[model samples]
Target: MRLPGPHWPSVAGRARADAGPLLLAALVVAVVTVLAAAIPPLLSATADAAVRDAVRRDGGDLQVHSRMEDDGGPSASRIRHPRLAESVDDFRARATEELGPGLRAAVHPPVATVISPTLKITDGSVLRTFQLAYLSREGGPAVTWITGGPPEPTGSETASVPYGAPPWPVQVGLSEADAAALQLRPGAEIPLADDQGNVKKVQVSGIFRPSDSADPAWRLAPALLKPVAGADGRGSTRFAGLLSRESLPDARLAFGPDELRRTAWFTPDPARLSWDVVPPVAAKVVALKAASGSSGARDGSLKWETRLDGVLRDVSAQVEAAFAQASLLLVTLLTVAALVLLLAADLLVRRRARPLAAARQRGMSLPVIGGELLLESAVTALLAAAVGLTLAAVITPGVALSGAGAPGPGAAGAVAPGAGLIGAGASGVSWEWIAPVVIVAVLAGPAFGTLTAARATRDRRVPANRSARRWMRDTARLRRAAAELGVLLAAIGAAVALHQRGTGGGVLPASAPALCALAGALMLARALPFGTRVALKRLLRSRRPLAVFGAARAAATSTRVLPLATLVTAAALTTYTLTLAAALGSDPSNALTLAPAPTLGAAVEGGPAAGPLAAGLLRLAWVVGVTLPVLGLLGLALGAAASAPERWQTLTRLRTLGLRSRETRWVAAGELLPPAMLAAVGGPLLGVLLAHLTFGSLSLHLLTGAGPAPAPPWWGIGAVAVAFVVAVAVVVPVEAAVRRRRRLSEVLRAGDG
Candidate 1:
């Protein structure tokens, strides 16, 4: 025969082809993921460090801040009540008396927000958003050290509608996008917009490049932020493009009365308390992709922050909790993705045993195969890596980095190490640690293929007729059906139980049913013995056509078919669930529903500040409200697609059974009638019982304004029902697609011809 084409080459070639996409995928995902995750922290830490350094260099021990809480002066209400104000005054005095006189403090009126037009672009300068009165217009040593520079100077009352944010908080730098969008360049003048929709023109000043976290403990990439230091010192804060004098308004509601100014951070350091009790509050003055969704710190109390052990700790705790939550979510996503990828790879290898066996018989070495695979993968990864790295660079511009003058190179190195071995967690990305991940990513398919090939060779017993392998090919139903059903039932039950038991009610049930559906669907894939043609024929017989006809056609492949199905099913479910839940579960009063999302956190340093500030409440409520929708919709969509793979097939089979398309869909759905009925009977009852048990209330029966506060509402049932239906609907279509792909003649020919 033809000298069995050198086994090694055949195997190597096959491997390279197979690995190209996966490696590229991994690299693309890893590079972007790491970079995105790195940004916010970097900015926060850098700014924090900058401020601290500035203070230290100035020989200040601590800084203090005081502001009016009510309508805010003159016509403005007092920000602090007498009792609380007295306590605050006393605290500041006590803290300062004890801490020493090295401390200093100054206060600027609470005019933080800036409105600017879209056209302003400045380079090598500051935007001067807020200029302090004492420091600006004075040709002497800053009586008030606003550091980085005083706020923006006053003049512009209008702005062009397209300019971006000015430099804020001193550390976060600027980027090309900000520059271009605002049309700012060094010494360029542009227009700005105010909240009231007013506009004005202003001079282009210097620009601040972005800064990443300087801490070696947890460094991240930087961001583009405009710094607005009245570099020329004119004492005014610019909002939008509107600028106002920094001096207490003899005109504009007499800014923060005299007493307030005396204790303001920019003023005298009365309390002398170490900012250690609270670090700097890095308000997100501009909208950032990094802080998507949870934008705005409208509620004065909710936005405060502090420092702990040289790191961040939230006085509000709400934001901190959210970050922790985000971390958990990311971990969950990573875990699920990795699990699905591994399983899919394993399944693909198993199905491809025949091809692998043929290659091995031709003579191939595993290492050679692996090398070739690695080469293909490396090339793809390198390309994607270059793209991702470049994007990271673009998003995070180089740091201007001169703080109190650029830190010593030694200091920079000591602080940021940038080296692999330094302060990177006690355990981080070690060779041994990476070994498994690498092995899994690089060798999983090949190793598994080899084993499968060996098995196939040992059992190299092809059927006399392809149809003769029916038993092996079509027994998937027997193997997977009952187990899948049981798993799904168990998952639903478990979710209910957890709710009852006061365990995490977030998404546990959703997870369980999803896993059951995926497992069952995958297992049942083996039961499809109709052959490619038979599967296609069935599709022609399917009801409610195109939305589903392709499903069967695509499913014709006997090998690695389930993996594709799994991907589709999971993705569909996740999106559906997320969207549905977000829409339905909006309970503004619940912890899950509160906007400005109050995390039931600790009170501020001086306790609740002042009379009724509706604005503050509205802001707080808005933040809290975000989570409910996100969680609800996400859960809804995910729950629907949980059983997608099987549901899709089930629908397709019905369509093939001579039923009208709509009828076929109805019949397939009929299968879930009993489950739905049961869920209806049970879900609410359980919800009530659990609500009763946990909150000692039976408000679940009531709709809005329902019963006692905090009890799960009656509308929850409707929402859950919708989520369940969505899950079923999404999966059924996939099944319909799969069923319609088969042809009766081909199936018959394969069996008898």
Candidate 2:
């Protein structure tokens, strides 16, 4: 339906005439859309960091260890599970296959034994002996072999004492004190004994030192035993004493899998893992436990009890909750954004009404006009969406989700550091992101256009039956009142429910309050036409020409102003309610109490580190709270801008007719500023009131404790209001100056009415 070739200028000219609203609409849509794309990944990244930290601290995501009986300790025969090696190997292989490269597994020696054997080391001559504890790599990560190497010739496969010789000489690692007493250097052959009267001749393969914090059992005595001095003045190695090493049968005496009889730990790579995979990981843990049956069970003699880190379950729940909330709030914000854009579109279409009528008079069909409008909206939506997505990509990573170092996830005052998982998580955009943005942008434009066209067509299709119109009007009024009453009752119910639910650090179900706020904003729209009528009545009584003209214009435009005002009100209330909830939820005292006891069926007790779940919620609240209002303000600004042209033309006429510049500015401000201010100021107040009504003293208490509610950022809100007023006041004179370059006839021709 678009005009072709030479006639295309008219289409382009009409677009330019409505450029202010189009651009403003695009800006509003872009901001909201970008936020929707960016928030989920950011929240997920934040929650992942919390989970990662928990896993790191707890050792791994899951632990499988032997569950020993409490009676003294298990007997030697019972403790030595011959099936342990096979079962562990099977479990590891299966888990690795299931979890893929993302799995990170580590084996830990039993907590009851951090040291291996206290071995008797002796000199060859007369068996001069020193007893000292030995530590292997599995025992002490801090143990550093100082010289020669790993004990040469790790023990052979045979379970008998005085076993077969290793590839190299039998070897043992000794601490400095042990080596000094034995007078043995690295590579020196030393004799060692076990309690079974079995003797093994071994080399002192390495002398090592253990960290101060290593088990005392792993360290040599403070002083070394000295042998009688020889002619060279060095202590003699010759001695006469029996030696032995004390240890249980089947104890893991080597680092290899065959001797690894205790417990094994497995964890997935936190960077690769997400909350969704927790259940499968848990299932693997359960399977491993089941495979390693109880101590005497015939299925498998090895007894393995598993403890998946408690944090996994909690963080998983929290992340899931956060994403759920994010999805809900995202939908709400988008709905508001669509409404704002629709209003702007409607205003733009109204400006084109005269031109459309002129085109129709010249024989242009409705289909052609519809086609051109669709093309315009599609191009605009696509351009705006691209800008929005690009902007989201650049700015999203700066949002901090890693609430680190705060006393758990719910720590009150800690803002998450701006780095950490952002680099690793959701740092980039993919097609999963691009597709939604394009679709929403495309859908938003057509949505607003169709609604606006419906209104315009309805107006043109009005029938000429006065009685029928009266009856229809009355029915519409009754329906509106019933709707308003229903909304009011719903708002009260929601407020009460919110109060009850949100009290004492509980999760606030936001849907009800959000609905209440939306309804309240629409209800507030009723005041606009009444206020405009009264103001017009008073203005008509004034002697001033600007007042009379401005008042008349305001009365004429009240229909357009009311719907925009309602949208502004809803956006403001939603923003304020969300912000208030965020503030309350983020307070340290208000953190949800994580389970203080261990989950059923798990051996370990107590909860994971506090704050991850709470912290994530805080971040969600802050993001939504801050973004919602900005969306509303953008809509408000665009709404104001769309109406500016008609108001400016009136001001220019007043200026030309003999009114002073200041009076013209005043008249322009008088017409435009009230509805914007009322929506902006009233929306937040209405929101807070509704929130308080729903959530009660708990809402207020969460914000401030025993004192007055911490003041809302009124100064910021006021600044926005003042800036809006000043801009409206300034634009009238600025446009008059720009239009001074045009002839008076041109100004007259620009009038929409």
Candidate 3:
């Protein structure tokens, strides 16, 4: 029953030691990749569930409102409705008292509203405000009121514009974060205009992300379409009216034909579980709508028109989508680790060429050896997969899912092989995400390993001219050449695909294609051997020996740098493109600095002064320092990390050349001079860009003329310091590699062979 010639266990034991570093590196890269992709979605999921649970448990089902008045009261006409309100306090009290346990409602008055203003671009083009509904939050986050995970508010100013349109920044969403990021809370400067008030300037007090039904947001005068700063960077804000509380009514229905029966305007937090709405004249039909696709009224503006027991499908979809994305990323990561193991198996075959040749001489059949190879590959792949999955589970944190990360459950990107999901669509694991991805990854790993082993074994042959082949025509050269070509194509394709997706959206052409890039890199790196480093040595002569060697080795050798560099490149591109787009795409409020020529919602007492007066009340002391840098420290971190390696390598060579470690560090630090300068220019300039864009592209000086200057990213400069320490670490090995040469004994041995 002799089945296999070579023992599978022997192959595993021999290769395991060599695979350790690659495995560790793979683990790190995979973990980081999964985290960056998954955290945002995970955080969003947590918040969404929390909000839904809190709202439903609170017993607030429906809210009926018509409009707001100057004294923070509902418009007179709305008060006439059976369950309508004149004052929010009156409504909150009465609803909790009368409705008892069945319904719960609380209304907070805003100082002013920023009505959908006509949008005029800087290019002198006009954009219509046909669809208008702007959300502007003030003060602190509403999460403080509700005890939950990351509070996912329904809709604070989801955008600067009234309806969905081009955000002033080229491509980014509004900086709809919590209070610590935005810097204000409730009761400060809420808002300026209202359903009845006439005002321009508004204040911010609190933050909330209400659903799309907040028609009252448009009660304030249209804010100017100007450039604004945001949490990420500089972008333009459309109708960026500050979310101030009720100051005075902006307008009222004077004399419409429906006098006692006109349509009513109301604003409710969609994030709330249910709303208690009493239709005009207490009509039975009430509808609801949301931009995120919440449903109630099958009709327009009525996203949901169901009875008291709302379906909540729309809200749930958003949360589940994010959770699914995180989970998928986790699965893909584990799958990638398995692929790495398979790649390792291929390398193991190549490294064991001498041992295999001896086996062949000992009368081992090809099929028997091949079978052993396959079994070993499978075991290794599984082991790596298990370890990777465990790493992923351990590193996951309590993240607040951002809608940005939620591309709806599965990222619709690469699929994992052999993955499985439990349920789907609000109930179970998403089949589409888990099944295909895991299955493909699992099957592909072993198949790939076996195929590569078969091919290498079949192609195994001693060259007719062993001497010429060793230097020029052997399997090593041919294999190295093939690996280089394949990896080049795959990595380039990955880079290209990454560029396309990042510039646009989604992962790659498919999940498999993205993984191909990884496979290609591994294949190329392993196949190329260390010979390529010798070939590329000339390219490093201009730098210090250590740097030159590092560059030569990192560049020419496939295994040394390809995988990590490729990953670093992908991560850099992702972080950079998204950050830059977000920085350039995000916008701040123009109302933060400019006031609207507030006009009454209805016929009012004070005319022009009324608008200014209400606006004036909003400019409070606490409101003085609410700055949001569209491009903040996140940008700095990315920039520094991108350039750290090269700087460190240069310093290493100097240290190896007998310079003081400290001196070498400084020299290495000096290498960062260009990027450091870049960080300097980019940091303050980003601040300037943010302030100007957010406040209508105004000329700026921090703390003196315009406002406070952005604080320099001392941390980025500190990165240079860290780079110096790294240089010392790199110097030792780099010098050894550079000084590497075949000794006379080795050359004589080679000649004899």
lDDT of 3 by residue, 327-388 (tens): 32333343433333333333444445556666655666666556555555445444544453
Off by over 4 Å in 3: 1-12, 15-40, 46-258, 262-269, 272-351, 360-384, 387-505, 509-753
Best by lDDT: 2
Model 1 C-alpha lDDT versus the unseen true structure: 0.33
- What TM-score, to 2 decimals, does candidate 3 have? 0.36
- Model 1, span 134-252: residue lDDT tens: 11111211112111222243322221111232311111112344444555554455443333443333433344332332321110011122323333246522322112232122111
Q: How far off is model 2, as Cα RMSD?
A: 11.4
Ordering by lDDT: 2, 1, 3
Clashes of 2: 14
Cand. 3 Cα-lDDT = 0.32
Taken over the whole model, the C-alpha lDDT of each candidate is 0.33, 0.50, 0.32
Backbone clash count, each prediction separately? 120, 14, 117
Task: State how far residue 388 of model 3 sits from its true place (Å).
Answer: 4.7
lDDT of residue 296 for candidate 2: 50
TM-score of each: 0.35, 0.64, 0.36
